[model samples]
Structures are given as structure tokens and as C-alpha cells.
Target chain A: MLEINNLHAKIEDKDILKGINLNVKAGEVHAIMGPNGSGKSTLASVIAGREDYEVSEGSILLNNEDLEELAPEERAHKGVFLSFQYPIEIPGVTVTNFIKTAINESRKANGLDELPAKEMLQKIREKAELLDIDRKFLSRSLNEGFSGGEKKRNEIFQMAMLEPKLSILDETDSGLDIDALKVVANGVNKLKSQDNAVVLITHYQRLLEYIVPDYVHVLHDGKIVKSGGKELALELEAKGYDWLK
Target chain B: MELKEKLVASFLAFENKVSVDTDSNVHDIRSNAFDHFEQHGFPSKKDEEWKYTSLKSILKHDYNVFPEGESAIEFATVKKYFLHEIDSYKIVFIDGVYSSFLSETSHDGYDICLLSAALKQPKYKTVVDHFFNTIAAKKSSITSLNTAFSKEGAYIHIPKSTVVPKPIQIIHFSTGNEAELLLQPRNLIVVGENSHVQIIERHQSLSGNVVLTNSVTEIFANKNSIIDYYKIQNDEKSASLIDNTYVQQKQHSHVSVNTFSFGGNLTRNNLEFFQEGEYIDSTLNGISIIGDKQLVDNHTLVMHKHPNCESHELYKGIYFDKSTGVFNGKVIVEKEAQKTNAFQQNNNILIDDGATINAKPQLEIFADDVKCSHGCTIGQLDSDALFYMRSRGIPKKEANGLLLYAFANDALEKIKIPELKTRITKLIAKKLGVDLGFDL
Candidate 1:
């Protein structure tokens, strides 16, 4: 469902993602394992179309359409979801409002009718129960003054709400504790489905035990250096990326 | 007369009768305000207050002042704009003229009358005339302009120790066909010793044409009394307004005033609070939501006249379009007013690039024991916050609208009146294109 060939990107004239290539099909989960300063985050950000970063060269195709031709919001509507590593704290904007706006925008883009509050509330409650998210979470400002773990859970909750076809979990395990990581992994597992895809980006292989990926691709210096089966993550866990370097 | 010429003529007309009793402690203030206005002469472009707002637009208007005539409003019409909701000793003024026949007031409960009529009433003559010219008497030109043509204004005297549950509502409806109008509305409110009262004065335009409202309200609070005053100015954007309110506080009295300005092309409000008695406290909180080329200038002065007085002032503005805002606040502590604790803060947010804000908070303390401070800030929507919302799949416009409304919540939270707060919140949402009725 997604294809990338020789993708190059830079932030503020500083090259981050050099030539990179990857391919993924429906019902597949690919893990990109990279050490620090390896352009792992930059790749996730570039694919999400963050304006601060520029694409120097390369092409990304999703559903056989040029992804570069779309705006960040357009990319989102195209089912390109980036679970932000560090979710932003928007003070004074409630979580319910933020999620509602996103849901409507996505529906509008997908040519579907907007869901009103009556049905929306019921859906949110059902999703919240499935994810074990508290109802009070809907009232607070969007990640404002939230704990690190709550933010990660909220990101997954948003993913659950959007029901994106392709979700990129960018370092979603970085700030989670063992318990929180379990909760996050459970949420991802519940959301997994065939005919869709999940790209799990991480530094440590510890997250692999909870939600195992179908393919493990070692991303070193902006390019995918190695690709293997799910056991490859456990192998990397046993022998860290430093040995690969 | 030419526009500038008429203003100069108006100020010229009031320059002579400006006087204060020498034995009274406030005589020097009277002299200062008189000399200030005399030299300034109705704030032309040369004055800072008149920089963005030009009175010349109204001066060139070749309209006659609406003479007092038959009132179009009934007691039921009066009930619409009333604040306290229930039975009020309602006072009505049409075209700045006191309507005697349409007004229903009773001395059995309190003292309410037209300032002109009270001047002739035997029992109320002393209290009525005591503050008539004392509030803004300093600007002989201003009082001269209003009083020289004083056809009508509300004069209230609350009896000692009487707590009025229902707020007295004063309604001014301008009804005339003239191309231009000039209204000199006035009010003299006296809260008797230890009494409590709330006064709401709502200004409306029936003509909805180019007009000018030059209004002044003078409030006097007796010892140990509390007075809550509210002013809502929603006039036609084409109209020009200049409202100057001078307030005096007695010993141990507390006075609070809230000004909500939503309309007018160029509106200037000068609110001066004097803490004359020991332990007196006063606070002035105001909010203005502006659009287009509207200019709202609020100049405030807090004077600590005696020892142990405390005052607090906060004035905020949310400016949209190419509108401009000016908030100049002064907190003055006299030498005798030792241990005075006064604070002032002015915060403004400009929604659009073309919008502008000018804020100056000043404090002059003559007493060493006084604690006085002031601060002002002009900030815009946070770019990082905006992008964060946008990244969540929210459209750029919808994201901006959310953040902008959040920027206004700080001011909306300060409105104490629940009904008014909800109304203002909805009004803000409607203006910012959050038509779904934002739940604040």
C-alpha cells in the first residue's frame, strides 16, 4: 500500500534524511529500528509533511498516488497518520473539540457525512471504554498539563478515533513506563487490522515484545540497511544496533 | 461651525462656569481637570487620546440636537434593558431629556428623580445638588457642555441603611430623524450610608444613523455602602461617543464599575476613581470586543486620597479587523494616603495583522508607605499552538478560530454577571465564526 524510493529531506538547510527506500503491503506491520542521530524522527516527520522540513529529493507513493503533492492536512486526510512522538499541548482547547474537528475534517475529505454530537458522543464513549480512557479526558485541554504517559495514550486514543488506514507510531514507546507501555501496546493491538498497515518506528526492540511487527528493517543513517522477519527484532534486542553499526 | 470649530466652541462654551469650593478638599482636582480640558479643547489629533479616533467626523455633521419630545418607550419597553430583572424604580430618558409622565418612581422606597427636578425638591435638593457639578465639574468645558444644555439625567439617592434588592435600570433611547444627533446624558448616583445598590445604564439608538453621544456619569458612595455599576455601550458603528465618568468613594465604602463596549466608531471612556475616605476600596474591570475600524479608548485614573485605601484595576481588549485599542491607566497615591495598595494591569490581543493596541500603565506614588504597581502586555496567537491544532487534522481556519477564542477566554472569565457572561461569550463566538455556539 505504500512505496518510497530514494527519499531525501532537510531541515533548515541541514540534510537529515538521505536516500531512503521502503515498501509495505496491506495487513503488514514494519518496524524501523535506528539509533540516536540516525534521521529516524526526521523520516517520520517528513512523511507527515511537517512544513518546517523540506523535501530535497525523493518520492513517496501511497495507494499509488504521489504523497508529496498533498498538504500535511491533505496527507492526513489520505490516511497518513503520524502518532507524534511528543504531542503538542494546546492550552484552552478541549480534547473533545480537537478530536471532533479532526474527525469531521477527515470525513469531509473522504466524502462522508459529518457526525453530529449525539452519535459522536456514543462512538467516543464506546472507543474510550475499549481503550480504558477516562471520560474526564474529553474535557481537559488538548494535552495541556498532561503526564507523559497520558499523552501517549491520548495519541493512541486519537488514532483509534480517526481509524486511519495507515498509522505511523513514531517512538510511541519512548516516554511510557512499563505499565503505560503495556496499555499503549494493547491499544495498538486492538487497532490492528488486515487491508491496513502500521509502521512502528522505535529505538529499542523492547516494544516489539508487546506488538510484534511482521518485518524488522534496520534504519541506519537515513536508509533502510537491513530487512528481516519478526525474530529479527528480538535478535536486535539481544545484540544492540551499536554492533550493527 | 466647522467640525473642529464646533468642538472648540463646545469646550469654549463650558470654559467659564468651571468652579470648585475652595474649602473642599477636592478643589485642586477641580482646577486641574478644568485647566487640562481648557488647554486640550476636546482632544483633536494633537492629543494622544484623539490620535486614532477623530471627532472631526461628527463635528462636520450638519445635524441638529434632538429636542425633548414625546417618548416612544413604555414601562414594558423599559423592562427589556433592565439588569436586576424584577420591579425597578425605572427612569427613562429620551433624547437626553427626562420624561416625567412615563417614569414611575417612589420615595417610599428610595429617592429617584430627574437631576433638574430634584434641584427643586425640598428634601433631596441638598444631596442632589451636592454631587451635580462636583463629579466632572473640573472640566468646566465638559460639564459646561453637558449642563449648559442639561435637559435631562437620572438623580438617585438611596436612603441610609436600605439595601435595594432590585437594580435600578436607566434607559436612554435616542429617537429622531435628524442627520446628526448630540446627546448629553448624565447620572448622579448617591448610595446612602451602609446601603447597597446596583445601577445599570444601557444606551441604545432608535434612529440608527450618524449621531454623537457625549455622556458623563457622576457617582458618590456614602460611608460603608457598596455600589455596583454597569455600563453597556452598543451604539451604531457610524456614531461617535465620548463618555467620562467621575466617581467618589467615602470612608469604608466600596465601588465597582464594569464597562462593556461593543460598538461605536470612536468611543473614549475616562473613568476616575477617588478613594477619599479611610479604608475605601474601588475596582474597575472593563472589556471591549471591537471590529472593523472601530477605536475604543479607555483612560482610567485611581486616586488614593486617604491612608489605608486599596484599589485594583484591570482593563482588557480583543481587537479584530483593523480596529485599534488604547488603554492608559494611572494610579496616584497622595502623600497623606499612606499604606495605599493599588494595582493596575492592562492586557490586549490583536487578532489581525492590521489591528493595533497601545497600552500604558502608570503609577505615581507620593507616599513612601504605599505599595503601587502597574503592568501591560500585547500578545498574539501562539504560532506553535496554532500548528499543533492544525496537525490534529483540524483545518487551518478552524484551528485559528479555536486559538483566537481561547485568547479571549481570559477576559470572558472576568464577567461576574452570568447572563451577561453567556451573552458576551456567544457574541464573541459569533464574531470569530464559531457559529456552533462555543461552550465557554
Candidate 2:
């Protein structure tokens, strides 16, 4: 579902992702773990086509299509979703309206009609219920004055609504409590199917216990140096990452 | 002749055309006001209050002091300018003359009629004498000019303990019949003890003819009365407006003024409030969204003379292209006005490199125990927020529009009338050139 060919990326002349390669198939969950400043978040930003990073010499392919020339919105239209580590607060825009605009813009890019109001409302209610979000919360400004747990749950709610082909969860578990962690994990599991993929980027092994991963890749100094199964995460948590380094 | 000279010369002719009693007190007031205006011609840029705004170029035109012949305008042609969703008492002026056909006045419980009628009728003579040009700024040359030529405008009087059922709308439309025109409209409103009223005012020009309007309004809120006044300045690019509004509040009266400026060549709003009694509340809120070399300036003042009063002021501006804006809010708390709470805030966003805004807050507090605070902010749109919206598949332009709308939302939230708030929101969206899909 997603491929990175020796992704050589840098920001402001500082090389962050150097000679990294990875591949994930549909219906599978992949976990990328790394220590501080190990380029985990940089990799996610590069895949989402953030303009500040320069892809020195590499390619990011989704369904075998080159994404270098497309703008961020174009990539978003092509079913590439990035759950930001620190979501921005957009004042005066309700969460429901934001989601509606996003869905309609994507559909418009793909030459589809706008979703009818009733169906849109129904889908919003269904997805909101799936994430256990309050009805009043949807009417509030998007991420404005929201708690960390509420923000994470709102992100999961958006992911459910969009149903993207490839979803990258960048540090989704950092601010969640145990209850919020289970809720977000359950939401991701329900949305998982044979036609899509999920990539979890985490600093600890705690989130993996709820979602579980088919494959685990340890990134160090801009390269994936280790690959194992779910047990690898537990072993790393017990022994720390210094031994591997 | 220059516009200033023509106005000074035409004051007598304009006065002769009015049917009011020549020996009345309003006539003396007009004479004194004309003298004041004659002494100080149009304000020069050297004046402190006129420092940021220059009227030299706009006054170069040979404006017709009085509207020539009345041009017939259809209701359908100007219907869009009105708040047509609900029933309203409309006092509409076409080419500086009251259009009886377009007006819906009432004398049932209160008086919502024309100033010309009130000036002539014996029943309304007392109201005309007491409130006409009573609280106007005597030193402002532009205000004096409006007072000297004051004849056509709305006259509203809410009796004691009475409430007007419908909102009042005062609209002035310039027919563009002359090459260059000058219009001066004067309005008076008096809310008796424990009364309430809401007013909406607008000035529109139909064509590309050069139109300069100098309008003045005086309002008196008696004890425990409530007043909500809204000014919508969205005119053609060829139109320029200088609006001076004076408000006086008695004990426990609450008054709010909201100004929304969307389009015009040059617009200056001078709003002043005077608190005469104790425990009064005053609110001043404004929003300006303009682009393409347009200019909008808001100058406001609040005077706290009594004790235990509060005042709040907030103004927001969004400038695009070469557009420019200015916000100058002055608040004063007298020595005896203890326990006064005053707050002022001004926020602006410059959308383009060429856009500019000048925000200044002036506060004078004489009472030591009072609370007075003011703040100002001027910045560009948040790039982080833009990126967030763009990542959600919204285009860059649409994202910018949404962010701008968001920045102005706090001020829009204070509007009490829901329909007017919706209309203003739509106007902001339209000014930003995008559909935000929801009312903020």
C-alpha cells in the first residue's frame, strides 16, 4: 500500500532521513519505533508532503504513483492522511464543519458529488459514536481549548470519517490516558480492512499492546536497523534501546 | 468653487428650504453650528484627530451642495440593501430626500418618523428642540458641517417604559444623478426611562459617481433604557463617508455600538459615548474587512463621569492588497468615577505585504481605584493554522479565508441580533471571497 525508496530527506541543509527504505502491504499494521531525534516524526512529515522538507534524492510512492510534485492538499485528496503529533487549533471552525469541508473537498477533487446533508449528519453521528465523542463537542471549535485526550479522540474520529487508504499515526499515543488509548485503538481496529493500511509511530511500547503490529522496525540515525514482530517491542521496552545502539 | 466654500455658501439656502419655525431653538442651534463650521473650514491633516485621514483629495470635487432633482428609484432596485428577512420600520433617504413611498414610519406607542416632519409638527417640536444636535461634538469641523446642513434623517423617540416591536433601519442611497454630490444626514434618537430600541444604519451608492457623505446622529438613553446601534458601511468604491455619532447614557442604561465596514473608497467613523449617571454600561465593537486600496478608520471615545460604570471595546481588521485601516480607541474615567471598569482590545491581520494597519489605544484615568486596561496586536495570518487546513484538502485560498474569518469571529460573537449577525458573517465571507460553509 505504501513504499519509500531510499528516502533521503533534509530540512534546512540538515539531513534528517538518510537512505531509508520501507514497504507495507494492505490489511497490515506496521510499527516504527525510535529514540529521541531519530527522525521518526521527520519520516512521517516527509510522507505527508510537508513543504519545509526537501527530498534530496528519493521517492515516496502510494499505489506506485510519484508524490513529489503534488501539493499537500493534492496528496490528501489521493488518500494519504497524517495524524499530526501536535494538532493545530482552528478557532471559529466547528469540528463537524471542518470534517464536512474536508470530505467534500476530497470528493470534489475526485469528481464526486457532495454528500447530502442528512447522510452527512448520519455519518458524523455514527463516527462520533464509534469514538465516544460527545454531541456538544462536535459543535465546538476544532481543537481549540481541547484536552489532549479529546484531541486524540477527535483525530481518530476524523480518520474514521475519511476512511483513507493509507493512515500514518504520528505519536498518537503520547498524550492519551489508558482509557483514551483503548478507545483510539479500538477505533483504528474497527476501521482496519483489506483495502487499507496503518502505520504506528511511537516512542514507547505501551500503545502496541492495544493495537498490536504485524511488523516492527527500529530506526536509528536515519536508517531502519532492526525488524521483528510484536515480541520485539516488549523486549525493547524491557531492555531499552541503548543495547541495540 | 471648492466643496468647503460651496457648503458654507449653501447653508442659508438649505435652511430656507426647511419648513420648520424659523424662530425656534433648532434654528439658533443651526446658526451657531454654521458659525462654528465657518470658522474652522474642513479639518486639515495637521489636526491631531485628522492626522491619519486626509480629506484634501476628496474635497477637490465640485460637489453639488444640495441634491438636484429627485430621481425615481424602484423598491426592487434597492431592496437588497435592507434587512428584508423580518419586518422593520424603515427610514430610507434617496438623494438626500426622504422617500415616503419607501418608508414605514409609526406613531403608535413611539415615534419612528422623519426628522423633517418632527421639526415642523407642534406635537414633536419639544422632542426636536431637546435632542437635536444636543450631544454633538462642538469642535469637530466635519460634525459642525453636518449639523449646519442637518435636515433629512431618522427621528426615533421611545416613550417611558415602552418597547419598539420592530427594529428600525436607517438607509441612505445616493442615486448617482450628479457627477459629484455631497450629502449630510442628521439623526436623533431618545429612549425614555426603562425603554428599549434597536437601530441599523447603512449608506449605499448605486453607481460609480463620486459621493461624499457626512452624517451625524445624536442618541439619549434615559435611566435604565437600553439601546443597540449597528452601522453597516458597505458602499461602492466611488463613495466616501464620514460618520459622527454621539451617545449619552443616564443611570443604569446600557448601550452598544457595532460597526461593520466592508467596502468603500474612504470611510471614517467617529463614535463617542458619555456616561452621565452611575452604573451604566457601554460596549463598542467593530470589524473591518477591505482590500484593493480601500481605507476604513474607526475613532471612538468613552467618557465615564459617574461612579460604578463599565465600558468594553473591541475592534478587528483584515487588510488585503494595498488596503489600509486604523483603530484609535480613547477611554476616560473622571475623578469621581470610582469603581470604573474599562477594557479595550484591537487585533488586526495584514493579508498581503502591502496591507497596513495603525492601532492605538488612548486611556486617561483620573480615579485611582478604577480598573482600565487596553491592548493591541498586529500580525500576519498563522502559517501553522494554514498548513493544518491545507492538509485537510482545502485549497490555500480557502484556508486563508477561513483563518481570516476565524480571526474576526470573536468580535462577531458580541452582536446581539442573530439575523444581523448572520448577515455580517456572510458579508465577511463574501469580502474574503470564499464560502466558509457555516455562520461563525
Top lDDT prediction, candidate number:
2
Docking class of 2: medium
Worst 10 residues of 1 chain A by lDDT: A89-98
Instruction: Enumerate residue pairs that collide in model 2.
Output: none
| Positional deviation of residue B260's Cα in model 2 after best superposition, in angstroms | 0.9
Q: What TM-score would you give candidate 2 relative to the actual structure? A: 0.96
Query: Which candidate tops DockQ?
Result: 2
- For residues B1-440, could you state the per-residue lDDT of candidate 2 as single tens digits? 87777887888887888766865688888889999989999998799898888888889998988885877789998989999988999999988988888989998889898887888888887888777887999999889888887777899999999888779999999988988989999999999999999999999999999999999999999999999999999999999999999999999999999999999999999999999999999999999999998999999999999899999999999999999998989999999999999999999999899998988899999999999999999999887777777777887888888889889998998887888888998999899999886545
lDDT of 1 at B57: 61
Candidate 1 per-residue C-alpha lDDT over B33-143 given as tens digits, one digit per residue, 9 for 90 to 100: 445555645556766645655666666786555454565666475554555434666687777666665666657678776765564446664674466667675643555
